[model samples]
Target: MKDQIRSLQRLLAALSSRERAALLAARPAVLQQPRPRTLHQLAARLLGTASLSRSALNLGEQQFLEAAVAAADHARGPGLPFVCGRRDLEQLLGVGRGVTADRFAEVLRSLTALTLAWPDGDRVWLHPDATVLFPTALGRSAHGRPPLPAAAPLVVAAPTPEFRPATGDGHGSGAAALHFLDKVLGAFTEPWPALKQGGLSVRDVRRLARILHCPEQESRLWLHLAVTLDLVTERHGRWICTERVPGWLRTPPADRLAYLAVALADVQILPGLPTQDPKLLNQSFATTGPSTHYNAATLRLSANYSAATLRRTVLDVLAELPAGQAADDGPALAAAVHYRAPHLFGPYDPTKPPVPPRPDPYGHWPKPNVAEVTAAVLRETELLALTDRGTLTDLGRAFRRDPGDHAALRAAAEAALPLQEKATILADHTVLVPGTPSPALAELLRDACDLEFRDVRTETHRITPGSVRAYFDQRPGTDPQQLLDALSTRSTTPLPQTVTYLVRDTAARHGHITVAKAGTVLDVRDPVLATELVHHRDLAHLMLRQAGPTVLLSPLQQGPVLEALRAAGYAPNSELKPSAARAADRSEAMYELPQLLLPPPRRRRGPGVAAPGEWLADLSVDEHEPVGELARFIYNRAPSLGANDCNVLATALGAGTTVHVEYRTPARTHASVTVRGPRLDHADRLTSAAGRTPLPLSLSGLQLVLAVPDGRGRPVRGK
Candidate 1:
């Protein structure tokens, strides 16, 4: 047991000062004891019970340590300097049954790197105090379970509802990305109103859900992504499309999906926000700060892994599974991830037997644990088209290999996307786009119609009088014939009469009730329509006064009056073109928080005491003053140790090399001595060849010099 600590001390002593500092940085508790000036002190601090207990060893590493202790206990001969051979331990742990050679080797490397276990050539010298954390075979054998063999295997069969490869209309993430962008373009055609504080209210979310033709949750995800990518931003407390939208439209489809995937993965919860809100996932970036209605306790434990790490880990797990096989669902994926890395996602009580995680709650997997988080990210991957029908696509494979390789992601995304751009105009006032629509076709449809429903591979647009009137109001005096023509150009079938009549009638009625300056008067050509506005719910707050049968008085500004009428589903035209104002709104510069560049590292001041090199360089040695070669060597060397550093000294001691030392006299300031065949009495002290005098060596100072030997086993005289 004493030898184990001694061996560890020698190994630690072998490290350079920088290496020692780094080790301490990695394990802070190792430095909590009185500042260690010697290797023995550092080793003792590292091997202390507090440090050992807090090591946070992973499952595989813990198992390996337990097996090593068990193996050492059963050793037949020569166990004083206890060391466990790699192969012997592997066999005892049934490596092939549960652990792979690469995995085992990696575990060993980690153990050695932490200094928890020292590498002794082909064997490992376990820290004598490590057993305080691991149970011996005798302890385990009493419970009818020895700790020698490995535990659960890394890969497990995914539970049933068998893995099925996605097969559908040749549509995937690329198609989905295009569809999402198209909806964003249409939804932001008008600036969305913002409440006094907080994100879209439930009513607002439902409205957006109606416009995007998806569930509230899915709609929120889209809005979140749009905000994160800077395609949409708040202006005057209302969300509107940024100037980047045009540039975004010009970006290639695949590149757009890649950009979205990257942004989605990078979304992080703002600090000081309630993470327990299930809606936090949706509004992590949608609003300034998010608050939710769900109880925090209803939410599962905080995620053990970050979104990016969890995403990458999920990708890796899928990549490792057999071709055409997936983890069935998020729980299966979670199980696989936990098996691969138990250190993350842990409730691992050594006192309790290991068991599977409980099934998640019934609805809204609020802020979830590892399993729930995995499931959520999996859905995102599906939306990104990285995974299809529970299997990785070409894009998924490429992304898994190199997420930063934008070129590859684009190419893979291009291949997976469906290219059909034509829509079939039905007689029932609906247009059905069979596959992903081109930007031109999508824009045309959104201009003349409302998105009724959308899916992975299809979209249905419904043309109505209200939609046409709204379009004409945005672009007054723009012939409704032009929009109809554009829609006709993109459609496979001719326009239906219902759509044609709806557009022409809506266009003719769009410009009635023109507002004058400050909207003080309303001149309406239709008395009944003007009368209807006074009773309309959306515009009732306007409080219009009937000055005459066809004229109404308003107290609001021109812009507010027009917005209120439009909100009431009336397309009231402005007296002015308003094109410049609309253009300015569209041209509102994208507001982005400037990225602060890190300042350059400051140059450290030189120590008060000059370094050894500067001191040695300044020394005025007299060349003709009869200084011996050994004395000259000491004069030229650094003030501390030279080439014979701790590593070299450790190697020489391990190889049992004969030595002759040229060292400075301890009692005399300007004197030196040369002794042949001196030996290390202990780790830091040397014994004279006569075995009587002991000299303590200061590793940090130039105290000892070794005699260089020739190939023929004799000391070589220095020139």
Candidate 2:
């Protein structure tokens, strides 16, 4: 084992800085840990138990590593390294007729490049740490060989008879979803108590679910979506509606759907706070299932791709089906998606049930499998009216083509969705909307009547006494007559007598049984005394009033009111309920849309590195002559500026380009550092890596500056 470790160390030491960067880039979990200061530490990190399990690998790469581990286990104890020939690896991988030589070779190259396995002579040396990723679960074939590659499942088209062409615009689901979302947002217009961990408590979640008339699980998702879309935010340990609510409320249904579709596409994980960093958002959620919390290990493993990428991929695959047709199943669709972008998707087994995620210290909920994620994406499409009856719609196609094009999304939606200005008013207090009503009419109906049923083509609202009373209670000054006028203006036919009578009668009883607040109440044995206290001159500031012949009420606190009454020549006994502490008010910044137009989903940029062959060739260059990409960058002199020049460096930083910076050290020696993903901090120092080491380099010390080649080895043109 010690010999194997030493061999690995030597191999790592031989790797150039460029090579090391490329290899470590694939193991983000390793980079996330404390930086390794030496080759041995780097090697140890590469083979660490935690890093091995968390590293993202495609199915092919995973299979290759498993085969290597199995071969090592077969040849010797698990701790010893085993050299396996190319032929043996091919056999162990079950790479038979279906697998091509080039494809197999590419897999090996990727494994070697990633340092999961490395070439030694004509064979490959397997890292014993592979056993951590793939234990003894190497099922063998009948001939006692590893099983064949788990081929991507084929996507079969649904039977033609199963295809159901939507007859009307498929905007019903989205419209209904938007209505429910508005309700959820409206609930937050007032501050709501939150737990210390910055999440809604169980009782609060249940209450919110009840208010939204949605199931608890689904309601939580909607609540999270409100935060994700920035329509609501947390402030002072309380949830409150953002200023964006007003504009969002006024947006047309189609426009609102377009905004929501884009927002949902950008959501990489469920039940997470909204963040500006797209990568952090991508890393937070393991599965789109109902899980409210994810541990660090699962989060690290799931960071290979963003949810936006997955959403686009799923929509693109679904678009391939003939109009009106859908895929057979989610697993098949997920397989096709993986086949298209294997690098983006980690190892996913559709045939197996999802591995249950370890209970998060914060919370526990069900985790999703690959198939479930695909299904969840499809469900989101359905919710946005992007797809109808499980098939892609015109709007869906438009969104799939370009989710960022808000105008195009809204245009497609408008063309498909039907909108009505007037609704049908029937007898027996029933209001029927044959099509989606205008926003104004819909709001009036929702506020004035009780919704009984709603679907794609129609909605049923009944004007009930209780619903009217509740609406009137919520709107302090709005009377039944005002509501009636608004309803009459939006209705196609005259209001029925039953509806009119119900509204008027409900309004009449709204404040009949009044409830009023009182700080102190006094009981007087004599009715005359109670009446006199109500009109007492000394206690006039208390604004005392008579509730009954024997009862006297005051708006002030019990202490002050009682003292005033006693000083006014009467002794009053007191009984009071315990008062709760009031929260201290603090001003918070109001949440607003970043811009009128939806911000495009942020695309995470990877730090640039030279291609493999180029980096290897640079290793053989002469000492004095230019070596490595950085040296070549300086040699070519694409463009050069004074070390203190902030113009070029600023441009490069904004563009997320790598910069080759030559700076003077305090020792008066000149040195160069390749700044990857450079950013100027508030202290005016550039923060990024100088080779594999991250350090803050002062901008004033720079002697010369030039931009480096992008990851693919193409030089970035400079000004």
Candidate 1 positional error at 655, Å = 29
Question: What C-alpha lDDT values do all the predictions have?
Answer: 0.58, 0.61
Worst 10 residues of 2 by lDDT: 580-589
Candidate 1: lDDT of 665? 42
**Residue by residue across 175-244, what tens digits does model 1's lDDT show?**
8666876687668879877766645555666678797776655665677678778888778888788999
Can you write out model 2's per-residue Cα lDDT over 1-719, one digit (the tens) per residue?
32343456667667777766676666664453123334543454455422343235555676667777666555554334355665666665556655666667777777765667776655677764555566543663324445434432112222122233445446556666676787888788889876555656656766888998866545666776787788877778778988898888667778887787777765655322122223443342322223334343122224445566667766766777665566655566777766545565446786786554444576543233455556666665666678765667778888888878998888887755567788888887888988677777777787778888865568899888877887888887677788888778888999888888888887777786767788667778999877777777887888878888898777666666655667888866656432311111112212234767778999767655445435433332112333344334333332222212343466666676666665545653446666766765677566763344246766545544555665455546433
lDDT, candidate 2, residue 681? 65
- Model 2 per-residue lDDT at 447: 75
Q: Indicate the worst ten consecutive residues by lDDT in candidate 1.
A: 617-626
Residue ranges of candidate 1 with Cα displaced over 4 Å: 1-58, 62-123, 126-170, 191-198, 269-304, 348-368, 421-433, 437-719
